[model samples]
Target: MKRLLRAVPIAAAASLAMPAHAQFAKPEDAYKYRASVMFLQSQHMGRINGQLKSDKPDLALVAENAAILDVVNKLSFTAFPEGSDMLANSRAKPEVWSQAAKFKQYADRLNVDVGRLLAASKGGDLAATREAFQATAKVCKACHDDFRRD
Candidate 1:
């Protein structure tokens, strides 16, 4: 009876985990997930920006936020599936599908700039972090200008 109880719990856990792996089963799911990730990234970036503007910027907080941004930047590309552009709630432009290669290039550039920002934050140099942040923000702006709808 104990073994049966343990097995039941294990089976239930496995079933719960299965849905997590199949999270983006539809195009709208992917679009919604991408929107959530973008929202998270923006929130983290805003935190870092707020810190940078403060008189006593906290390097530790900056490093943590930058690390999150680094990971989020890598994850942002995976959400843009082929048909995701057609989703009603998606702010992504149709050019994302038509100009896939260009969009990917911009994504790569943003990833690189985010990496630099993370490195700068880790180095604990406020000036370097500011410069890196500006570079990263510019990459984001350029991509948004070209691919995202206002």
Candidate 2:
């Protein structure tokens, strides 16, 4: 009885901690979650861009946004479950599911580029940060070109 009770709570906690992709009850929910995460990523990217364009860039602000982007980047890819791309507002292309390996490659590259951006920002190297930021943007553009619809 005691062991069963302990196992029950452990299972419940594990269920509660399920990945976002599995927690979605419907395609729409996944689409909404993906859209929200993308919006966050865009917003932070814009903030970092604005700072970069400034006469004197704020490395601290860029680092902060980069950190947020790292987390948001991870969330964005997980929300794109198989059926979510069928939604009316979804920009994801069929290739996202059909070419899953290629899509995953882009996702993995984005994570790596974003990590570099974060590291550069935190290191307070403006030149390196700019280069890393451009690389990150390139990955994003490449992924969108291949996987997103018009």
Candidate 3:
């Protein structure tokens, strides 16, 4: 009886801690989340770019930004469920779902490029960081061109 009571409260607390629509009750929610994450990724990328352009670039900030980009890059792909592409406000192209394998390949390339960027940033080599950033940008543009709408 004591164990059951303890488990009940723990279970309830765990359930309550989850987001209201943790499973995405509507496709719009997934689309919104995806948009938000992309915005965050862009912000981090912008920060890195700005730092690189500065007369005295801050390698620490660049590394921090790259780390953030690495994490966000991992998260972006999960937001695109089957129905998420159908959301009225979503800028995701239908090809993202129709050509899922290709989309995933692009996403994987992004992961690799971001990892390289993170590694270069950590090494504190400005030239290498610039090269890695260019590689990452190319992956982003390729994915966006194939999977996103204007």
**In lDDT terms, which candidate is top?**
2
Model 3: per-residue Cα lDDT over 30-80, one tens digit each: 678778889999999999999989998888899999999888876677666
The digit string of per-residue lDDT tens for model 1 on 63-145 reads 99999988877667766656567667788998986787687788778778888888888889889899989988898899999
Q: Sorted on TM-score, highest at the top, how do the candidates line up?
A: 2, 3, 1
What's the CA RMSD of model 1 in angstroms?
Answer: 10.3
TM-score of candidate 1 to 2 decimals: 0.82
Query: Would you list the C-alpha lDDT of every candidate in the order shown?
Result: 0.76, 0.79, 0.76
Candidate 2 local lDDT, 2-86, one digit each (tens): 2222232233224322343244666787788878988998899999999999999999999999999998888776666666676
Selected candidate, larger lDDT, 1 vs 2: 2
Could you tell me the TM-score of candidate 3? 0.83
In candidate 3, stretches whose alpha carbon ends up further than 4 angstroms from where it belongs are 1-22
**Any idea what lDDT model 2 has?**
0.79
- Candidate 2 segments whose C-alpha is farther than 4 A from its true place: 1-21
In candidate 1 the C-alpha lDDT for residue 149 amounts to 94
User: What lDDT score is found at residue 102 in candidate 2?
Assistant: 88
Better of 2 and 3 by lDDT: 2
The candidate scoring highest on TM-score is 2
